[model samples]
Target: MQLFEHNPIKIYNSLSGKKETFTPIETGYVGMYVCGPTVYSNVHLGNVRTFMSFDMVFRYLKHLGYKVRYVRNITDAGHLENDADAGEDKITKKARLEQIEPMEVVQRYTVDFHNILNTFNFLPPSIEPTATGHIIEQIELISTIIENGFGYEVNGSVYFDVHKFNETHEYGKLSKRKLEDLIHNTRELDGQSDKRNPQDFALWKRAEPQHIMRWPSPWSDGFPGWHLECTAMSTKYLGEQFDIHGGGMDLKFPHHECEIAQNEAAKGKSPVNYWMHANMLELNGQRMSKSTGNTVNPDELLSGNNDFFSKAYAPSVIRFFIAQSSYRSVLDLTNDGLLASEKGFYRLMDAVNLLEKLEVSKASTININAWRQSCYDAMNDDFNSPILIANLFEAAKYINQIKEGKETISAEDLATLTNTMNIFVFDVLGLENVVKNDSGTDKLTGAVNVLIKLRQEARANKDFALSDKIRDELAEAGILLKDGKDGTTYSVN
Candidate 1:
């Protein structure tokens, strides 16, 4: 039986504004599309949260035996400053400032984005299509919209007629805004804009003579609009309608709303089955914004080089911190929260390691089947990772009891426990054993051992200050030294 049939999965659908049961277009298969980074600058922590949430969703779907074709597009072109479809393209602006070609900026930041996501252990999407690569597809989509009478060409640029489309279909169903409200609330662009209505977004922008990124379109020598690439790329990879379309909650208004209008205008039906949105992440109770200097980069957090964190944190700790909360809720990044999660993560992993050393008895004390089912129950209820983690902690308590001989488990129950923990912790959660066994770890161990010997000699020689100095310095560097009956053992905290 398919996993969802046995253990049904529910997802919070932003389109419907409810938690709906996930039913794929085809049985036993899923096609998911998520918006990727624009590759103009370093990705912030908020972007990481959105991507990680989808990564968990992707991993869980695969774990449930679904064949998932996940497509996340790279916005290397057509993404503009302010997302207003008026300013210069982000990649082009960055290139002008750096005195290099636009492709260089895209290449540099795209590599950085991949490296950061790799550090967080994110599973790469199945198809990573780029906006620049699908220009022909975008042009075709624009042409179809025009031929369908929902788009118009003014001068050299093309704009989607939001007023015209809304006459037949609801334009703001996904965002839950009426056309009247949108028209009143829409901000007027400065100077003479080509759009008939401020709410009508660009389908194909006419490139200025000095614009660096320009292509040959039927309307003009121009580039695709900010919102056109996703519709084209998603329809190209997945069909006109797919299982899931996801992005950060901030994209819900103009970007995703425009996408819906474009697709519905060209095609007769809505393009996505379920619209999933990951909530924003905040820093110290305020929204993260780079302009206000209230943002933290992934590299800074991992390297502990920023003023926000007390010490360096492993990438796994950050990932575990994110998993502690639901993706639909706003997560505040605080030092205390991260430190607490760090302790919890280590405790969980320590129990998993101890499971192998646990001794089995003749009879089991706990119902292994019930505990296993609860894990699935938590995941099935809209991917409630926080609840799943609570269940994992309960399993950890049981593991500890088994280790202490306070509880007993039969061989079969023990095997189930082992598999359950492995699947949930490693495969589904995407967490790693951050403890390294490579040569660098060995080298560090050797150096620390030399220091331990020096400290021992200092103590023997009654050099109290030297021994205390070594201990205090190591502690400050996030290395905990445990002085046991068998000498000293050090661990990175």
Candidate 2:
């Protein structure tokens, strides 16, 4: 039997706003599409967080024995500077400024995107289709929408008739905003614009005389609109209706909403059974903004060359930090958080390294099966990684106790525990083991011993201020110190 049959998964549906038991369209198979980046610049850290969240989901589903075809598309063309269908194509604008071809810019940043993802140990999607490669499919999709009377042509450009579609169908259901509200909020369009309504979005835009990218279509020698490529490519690869559609939470309003409308406009049905959106990432405590200097790119974060972090962090530490929170919650990237995660990651790996050396006893003191089930239960509840991490720490504690000779485990239970930990840590969570000559505990003990000595000297000199500072700072870094009859000791959190 498939592993999914043994441990069912419940995914939080962005469309439904509730956790629903995940049922794939076909048995033992899942089709998932995530809206990928527009390759105009280096990939942002927020983008990395979003994709990393889904990477965990993809890894877990495969571990559950589901044959998953994951499609994440690249927007090499048609994404405009302003997402509302006005302004120059972002890639084209970048090419113009850099004095190069648009495809050159796409090539440069696409490789950068891939490199960063590789650094973070992300699994490449099953199909990484590009917008420029799917122009014909987009044209055909637009033709179908036009034939179905939901699209209109003006001059050489085409726009989806949102008012007409909303008459028979709910236009804002996915985003939960009423059509009337959008109409009220939108500014009045001048006579210069072609759209019949302000809420209408472009399906294709006519190429200007100096436009860098253009494709021949029934409407015009132009590029497809930003929203059309996803509809064309996702349906082409996954089908009219697939298992899941995912992206960052920011895409909910017009990007994903437009995809929904375009799919229903062409195929007369919702394109996905489950919709998932990973929450945004913040730097420090505030929202990451480039203008405000609160932003850090993936390269700067890993290299520690930016103003944010004190030292460079390994990819696995960052991955572990991201996994410590639910994908649905906003993740804050702070230096303290990363340091704590680095400690926790190494501690977990230290326990894993000790598993083989652990001596088996006559009886298992811990209930191995129950602990295993709790790990599965956390992941089953909407891919709750934080709870799963907590459970993994519990297992790590058990391993430490066994090493201290305070606990016992049978040979069978030891094997089971090792297999489960390996599968969840390396396979499912996509974390790489950081092999050290000396384990994390050994290093932490050395450092804490030095600090404990300094603190003892400070207390003996009646300098309580310095002693408290050392102790409190360690606590902030997720370490605890204790003084007992046997002098002082410390624990790595």
Candidate 3:
């Protein structure tokens, strides 16, 4: 485990409704399940925020030497317009509109989904299960719920008995809502002539003729419900009892709450130890949603077609922009905010490049150990990434000072600082500078060399004013330079 000196990581557990110290179920193994995207369309920025937060957690746990089996499921089927019970699956709807096979929709967007996540530098999960791959497991789970008297089948459709589950198992415990509120707030469920209560959600839905994504099951030619996919796939991969379950806060009620009842009904025990929810991403103080027409698709942003962005942003900058804020808070997207984040990101990258090149002193002037501790402290406290970033920025400033001959570092301290920055920023946070595929050209190399030489001559002549002006001007042209004790090195921004 390469954890820092002060790695007492605390995280806000939605299960306990408070921040608690994180300890995996097993001594050195962690089982984490995160709800993944429903492959109906392109994933928006709001959806990516949740994954980014979990990436931080997953990376940190791995960095701490925990053998973590991270599972994030893809909903290839069963997610519907009005929850799982109301009617048509979302993917099916898209297929109908596009006049394509349902699997075509699944394959296209699933590929697109992976591309976007990779662009943002998200590590692929240990197990990326699709709902369509585990139909038998979902059927077995529905059967168990029925045998345990918490689910009922009518007209070949199975619905969980939420009201009855509430009587014995506290159905609303996860969401902190009274059963009465749910009943009142829930409008009369559609296609619910078979359900015993309005709050009872489907565990298995009997597919109609137009529904093309169903599997043949004991119940009928049907598909698993939206919540059933997560419950079945996670338990099958991670186990009936696991450490953590995470998703967007919008899934708190009905989605996650129903999942709890389904798992308890089948397993006769709580499925997860900790519940974590990342808040939604907001746009102009309003939620960015598909229906609201304010969603920013990653592909659109990458192509510079998003109305909110005037120019295309590199993937690393977009990743950092989301990570700069705490996961639990809503990150409101603004052009000014993103521009500021771009500058900070480049500054951080510049310092990172300068760290190893720094000259070592006999004794330390800046406290690298304290800075390292602060980085761990921020992460340990519920994976507070913004604070971790702030600490990294402080470390970056010191690195810049040492590069500029303003501070000094011991040889031992230099190694520690390098290791700390690499672990926290690159491995744990999963941020990186873009690596462009450029064939080395004589013209390009000559131009860059000429600029560096000119800067060198300016510095040798005690022309501090000229040196700063050249640096600033070249920076605006997307060339960043670091003036080291020995010489200056540069990288294209």
Candidate 4:
């Protein structure tokens, strides 16, 4: 039987404002969509926490034996700097400042995003779609909305008719906002602007002459709105109605709100079964703002190169730190919090490593079945990772008790405990065992040695071009390679 048969997971639906028993539209399959990053700059730690939350959700769902089609869309275009209808495209803005092509900026940061995710042991989504790649779909969606009378064209741009849509549909149901309240709060639109109301968002933006990321459309040569890409890509991949749609809590209004409007206008039905929002992340009790100089990027934290953290933390330690909090609660990350998580993370790993050395007794003293079920029960309750982690520590305590001869497990129960612990700790939690010798620098050393050996082989084969390229790349990463007559050795600065 599939593990999901007994799991019966519950998800807190942001749309419904309560936890609901999760029932996939398909019998044993799930369709999930998450809004990915706007790759204009290096991804911050907040983005990491949001993605990591969904990563844990994805991991747990798969562990329950459901075939999941997870689709996360990359906002390569159409993401304005202010996250609204009218501002410079973030990628385009970065390109102009750096004097490079917009796609160059996208490609560079997308690679960086992937590298960071890989370092933190994140599972790649089943289908990763890009916004720029789905422009045709977005254009078609806008045409459908316009034909359905929820959209109007002014000048060269198309905007969603919020008042018209509200007459027939609830404009802000997901955000739990009323159209009147939104209108009352919003300032009146000036006659000089193209929008009919301040609440009406852009469907297609009219590109200025200086805008380099424009695409040809029926209305004009322009780009899609920031919110339109998620609707287009999510609908195209996950269908008109899917299982779950997730993003940061900050995107609940306007970004996700506009997505609901777009999909409802075009598809004529609600687009998602469960709407999930991961809460915000703060650094040292304050909002992580770039202007205040109180932000810590993933690279900085991992390398101990920033002023925020006391020492270098491994990727798994950071991942563990994030998983300790509920996704719906704002997580305040401090040096002390990370330090506590570091100790806890190693304790869990250390217990797992000692499983093989544990001796089995004739009869079990503890209820292994109950302990295993407790872990499952914790996850089944809205993917409550903090509770699940607490259960993990319970088992760790049992392991230590068994090691000290204060507790005993039967051979059958020991096997069950070992398998269950492995699944939850390594597979479901998505944490890797740390190297005790170097506090996790051994992996980097092993990787660098692989490259050094490849460069040596290239030199032996008289491929100086390949050899020189390897040397130059390692030099850029602060890994100095000294190739003596004996062999090549490396040192990190």
How do all models score by TM-score? Answer: 0.91, 0.88, 0.91, 0.87
Assess candidate 3 and give its lDDT.
Answer: 0.84
Shift in Å, residue 309, candidate 3: 1.7
The TM-score measured for candidate 4 stands at: 0.87
The models' CA-based lDDT, in order, is 0.89, 0.90, 0.84, 0.88
How would you encode candidate 1's per-residue C-alpha lDDT over 71-138 as one tens digit per residue? 99999994766434454887888899999999999999999999999999999999999999999999
lDDT of 4 at 358: 82
Error (Å) of candidate 1 at residue 83 is: 7.3
| Candidate 3, 1-493: lDDT as tens digits | 3443236567788978998877777777889999999888888687888998898889998888778999999889847676434458888889999999989999999999998999888999999999999989999999899999998898888889988898899888888999998777887644667878888888888888777887888888988888898999889998889998999998998788988888899998888888999998887678877797877788887788978777788888878898888888888877778789888988898788777568899988987888888887888888878898999998998998887778889999999999999998899889885532122465665676687788889889999899888889988998777664676666785
Residues 1-493 of candidate 4 have per-residue lDDT tens digits of 9999988999999998999999999989999999999898898899999999999999999999999999987889847654243547778888989999999999999999999999999999999999889999999999999999999999898989999999988888888899889878976544427878778888888888889899999999899988899999888888999999999999999788888888889989889999999999999888899999989889999999988789999999999999899999999999999999998987788788768768899998999999999999999999888999999999999998898788999999999999999899889889987733212256877888789889989999999999999999889987778664446656553
Q: Each candidate: how many clashes?
A: 0, 0, 4, 0
Instruction: Give candidates' CA RMSD values in order.
Output: 3.9, 6.0, 3.4, 10.5
Q: Which residue segments of model 3 deviate by more than 4 Å?
A: 1-6, 83-86, 435-447, 454-491
- The candidate that wins on TM-score is 3
Superior by lDDT: candidate 2 or candidate 3: 2
Flag the better candidate by lDDT, 1 or 3.
Answer: 1
Please provide, for model 2 over 325-421, each residue's C-alpha lDDT reduced to its tens digit, 9 standing for 90 to 100. 9999998899999999998998898788779878899899999999999988999999999999999999999998998788999999999999999
